[model samples]
Target: MGRGTGPSMGLMNDLGSKACEAWLSEHGEGLPWGQVVAHPCPNGWELRHVADAGRDAAGLQALPPGALREWADTADDGLFRPLKSAPTLRRGWRCLVSSHDDLELALGGVYPGGLGDWWAVRTGQGGPTSFREFMGRQTGVYRGVRGLADEAARAVVRACCHAGSCIKDRRWAVEGMVDGEPGGHGSIPCLEPCALVLEAARTMARMASAERTSVALSGEDLAVLRAALERASALRPPPGTREAELSAPDNPRRMKLLLEWLGPEWARPAASPQE
Candidate 1:
């Protein structure tokens, strides 16, 4: 939208900028925040509650100056999750989505952690509604950046579309494809939406290589494909993200086998955690 940040949003940006400046002053400018922090922006910054309306301007004006980090720097190019949680929603400091894109478009987090499993939901008739359907009606920033690049990415988005319809809407077939498949866990049949998305991506990359050239992804073509798929990957909320979290296999057996893939501050398991 506009490049304006309302009174509240303006204040958050001020604090986030200040926090970044403070961090860089200590941390140095050689490295980037995305490389340093896994869950960057709106999460791992310093913030003090500013209750006084009078003191805010001074805070904004007094911000330490330098070539500060931008939202794109921390943006995983829509890798894990694109939506950032608003700090006002939580009692913490949040980073700016970008100076160019209105601060109003940075709705990244659904709920902060320390509250328990951020993905828990009610079962039975009162189960969670379709996240995309729910979010479509809202004015959150997540709605601002939706959609993917190619048919495969579209497949991932469609499969990950949060419609509990998969639970019942069996348009695919009577096969177990609707149900989640195994990754490492010996779950039921069918492809897990997350695994399906990843697999679809790999398949697409392979096809892209074969169709375009026998060489690997490079230059602008690689960049474009990566952005599209990553954005698609980021669009799915935490509930959908659960599908990807599993470590099962990516075999699309016994099911239709057509590939497909955040919420809260969903914590990811380490690459190699101690057993």
Candidate 2:
């Protein structure tokens, strides 16, 4: 049977136990998304859970850069971003400044953006400072950066990272396999990709801080985008090759990608037994 595109709400018990479904919906936040404990209802909704998603160790793969936004879609829907109240970036966040283990950055500073949201950094005590203020003080690039309340900003950041961008060593860094690495299924992270992702995220945040929508692409949508990036990468200009001939051949959107203005994300690995 077919299922609803997203969370199935306001339905009755004939399809499944009202109380149980309600329990999962209410209590399943923040828990790693668990499996469907019960059989799916005729309505085609599976009773998914959230707990120890990391249990799938071999299943773990570094989240792709551009893909971060998609992952957050799972959070806002109340599936993974289990918040005390509604999921909002304005809740509370703490930044552990190494020395300040108990630094509570703000009353609200974290967003369980979703599957790929960086839970590690959000784990402990933060300070009363705004996330942007904290970030701005630390670096020149973030000097003018502000506002993490925008869902779209978060998405743009995630997608850029999935494409292979991240801030590492306290600076925007890109991780990827230029061509490919040993275990590198595709692009590895590096500095350029990180810069690209940050630029995109900032632009998106500035343009639409108020926009809100669940944007994790459907499996099919991700697959298509991935393929498109890969195909474009093939025509990228080789190093030191200054001639236009060194540039990507005439192709749609190929130039931007080949230029590494966008990075490629690593693919997810198969599930292994949890440690």
Candidate 3:
């Protein structure tokens, strides 16, 4: 089916419910989903950040399931989280939910359509949207992204979708891009380009079109820049750093893409899983 008209909301919700049921049946209710851990209790299900899963429930702040949306909307430092699946989910809170539907609702707030996308792929009713397919549908400012060179497109995909930035497995690919390893426990599949990706592409396209300036730098200068970007990539930015602010030269993804353009010698090692 054409991705634009893949499935109705009702059908997707039903499939997502089935996906939740099957997942629980297979992995048990205690298994973690992304950064959240869901445990079936006599009362219903108790949800907490994986970091707090082993902590005493009394030690963590208790929050209503409805509050999860706001909680997940921002990181622990109050920065907007553009990607819900990003590893930066805040900890130190627990939620109580009463029914399977409520549990799904709670999780939906945290991951947004994650369960539906999982089931859609598993059932073969949906699949990844290629970069070409995704950009072809773009309009307005994003229309310029369609003109991005293949090399720039791949770099954007790698920088924006790297596991270091988001945990969702990137099922989508563009020309010259290689497949990424499947994500581990608690990870979900990303079936298409997100808004952030589209915006990043637009930015890169504009950057590629801008007037070029040349500056001479010593070998040591290049080395220092690479080292700095490496350190930046290896650590989370300080609280309040805007992750979605792509125009910032210091944005981690933009730094990574810059490293990509500098060739393999300047490339930083892959970010550690704990980063």
Candidate 4:
């Protein structure tokens, strides 16, 4: 796909360039100091928004003055307008897939499979009809293998350490094996999706370490984890599982198990405290 040539092109380019730099400094080199700014670019905000914002933001103040106007004038309206539409989702997906390929070229193919590849397969097979459908179809795959790995990894970490806390609390855990490295050793906590889990684990681990208590993976917790694994394993295309089944039930067994694993001190009553 061609780049949008709208008046916002220069502004977008400038923003993209800054974003790339920020991403690289933070993620690539582990820099300790850098300022990164992000603003929502809603569909209604046209080239003027980009130009105006660029002028206002300190980081973008250095941008060539005429670049924004020139970009707007030369940019193709048809290309620029469609980019503001919902179709941009697919376009963004494709860009991600391509970027992965580029990374593989430079970094020796670290990722085993591209998300776009899996998405393509799911969409082509007539799985879920939309992005929502795609998420439902694939979340199971993540929960099953990746989820199990995460659970097992945490369990093992707790078992081996003095903390006795679930690994989920100590570090971020990821679903896929990197470069065939097993037992989730190479996983980093900063990446997306898994990052949230890693943060939770880190918090738990810190708490356990501070309290001088070990994480206890009781039989009930294991059962709950296993059930989650089972649900993940049983997942199929959207139509395969009724929407009603996806909704959380009141007093879910999983919730009870999780609370139990956290211990009574951590558990709270379902209702809020009175004022």
Candidate 5:
């Protein structure tokens, strides 16, 4: 039941072990799985198939002694493929470039590094031109500015929309109260986003309690606690605030008080929830 342990933990460990094995097979020399190399497909055919075909054709021809016999035998079916012959280097490079282009298109023009980086590492040469470099070269373009501006605008819009929904739901809960009783148990429906915010607040309190017991509270920890309290205070319903009327005893006020004691910024509000 603990975080990151037991059967679930064992599964994670198994996955990590498999991943390491796969990586070593691909990059490690002298290994059966490592003998095979794949490049992008030439003529825009699928790379995996092309690589397999290339491996098969190369094995059929005169190859040097001590070549990967097992790889060549199973080359047509299994994951392993023989390295492309030295004569096919140019064709392989073309395939690599084409494959890289396809990946860039799929990712919406966001190329992480690029063909040049791959080529440099594979060929053991100077660093290749990277996606970061491409961005650097186009800094004066309107598209660059527009991309950043649009992202920022969207983030602001989402935050404001979330806050508005929270306020609206709180108002509805207050209006739906029976007999004007602050602590009345009414079946008030809440918006999904508002419910999420409440759930998140609850989760944070639980985490704080765990941290308080397990770890020595340092100055940095106090600072974090204070900041969290200030944030809760900012969202707290004003004294007699509509939200306070709907909230249970274990509500935002508890978070606010814990935060206030950590910092001056968390002072309790002057008015009561039903004032």
Candidate 6:
């Protein structure tokens, strides 16, 4: 699908460019944003994936501003990246921009409205949508998400919005909780829930509504399950696994939620706060 090109989008683009330029001037060179690192080169600026920040530019794929969208469309394994802010951005690419407009275009191609979101948060003009607000606005397939138990809802958010999955700092919170910490300068801010998170919430809501069948397992069995899930979560997803397919039992976020539900013994702190 094509991106919005209306007047509002143009204004956002301009604002994003202005904010980015100001940030660069204040922070100077070599500051990293999300998975990207930017540097002031002799001509203009050089941007590359954080993984390739230390590599020689001549060795990486040189892409123009216009090609960044295509370059960011897939992962190194050729999987379609459903979330642009996902930590799975492919490395080995470098982009050069001679002007702020070019930099805006290039960054937009890489992170979509990332700079604009950052600007909104920095300027206090926009903020995150709370879990309650996000659910209240849902319709059709996602409308039932409002019925999910509050704790269950928080678990879903924690699982899906975990830094392991996406890099955007979540400012939204479940009801009764305040906004998340505004991170240090240059961090990308998530102002609202994304479609993927909504999908996960929907999946969780459906699971919550399902009939409960008790299957007793010993502590050892539960331990084994936690170990297996922890191992899986740390490894690369299977080639056939779809990262955004929450209904699939093997999806990473689902595993994370399951881990959260299981209350893994290893996850507990050895030293209590009272200590």
Query: Can you give the TM-score per candidate against the true fold?
Result: 0.19, 0.21, 0.84, 0.20, 0.16, 0.85
Q: What shift in Å separates residue 13 of candidate 2 from its native position after superposition?
A: 70
lDDT of each: 0.28, 0.30, 0.74, 0.27, 0.29, 0.74
Model 5: runs farther than 4 Å from truth?
1-165, 171-195, 201-205, 208-211, 214-275
* C-alpha positional error of residue 74 in candidate 2 after TM-score superposition, expressed in Å: 38
| Model 1 stretches with alpha carbons more than 4 Å out | 1-151, 165-200, 203-242, 245-247, 250-275
How many backbone overlaps does candidate 3 show?
A: 1
The CA-based lDDT of model 5 is what?
Answer: 0.29
- On a 0 to 1 TM-score scale, where does candidate 3 land against the true structure? 0.84
Give a tens-digit lDDT track for model 2, residues 88-178: 2111111111111101111012212211122222332221332243434434544334543434433443433332212121223223223
For candidate 1, the C-alpha RMSD (Å) to the true structure equals 18.1
Better of 1 and 5 by TM-score: 1
- Residue 233 of model 5 has an lDDT of 50
Q: Deviation in angstroms for 133 in model 4?
A: 37
Clashes of each: 17, 43, 1, 17, 3, 0
lDDT of 1 by residue, 130-215 (tens): 32333234343333312323443444434433232121111122122234421212101122223233443444344334444365
Q: Please give, for residues 63-159, the per-residue lDDT of candidate 6 as tens digits.
A: 9998999988888888788899888888888988766667678888988988778778778888888778888888987889877777777777766
TM-score of 1: 0.19
The residue-by-residue lDDT of candidate 5 on 1-275, one tens digit each, is 11122212333344333332332234222221111233323322222222343454443332222222332322222322112111111111111212222322211111112223333343455433322232234333222422222222222223222322221211122112234322112111122123232333333333334445455676557567666655765553434333322234334444543442243443334345574
- Model 6 residue 180 distance off true place after TM-score fit, in angstroms: 8.4
Evaluated at residue 222, the lDDT of candidate 1 is 46
Off by over 4 Å in 6: 1-17, 26-28, 176-186, 264-275
lDDT of 6: 0.74
Q: Higher TM-score: candidate 3 or 4? A: 3
* Model 2 lDDT at residue 160: 35
Q: 73 in model 1: Cα distance from truth in Å? A: 23
Poorly placed runs, candidate 2 (over 4 Å) = 1-131, 134-145, 162-198, 206-275
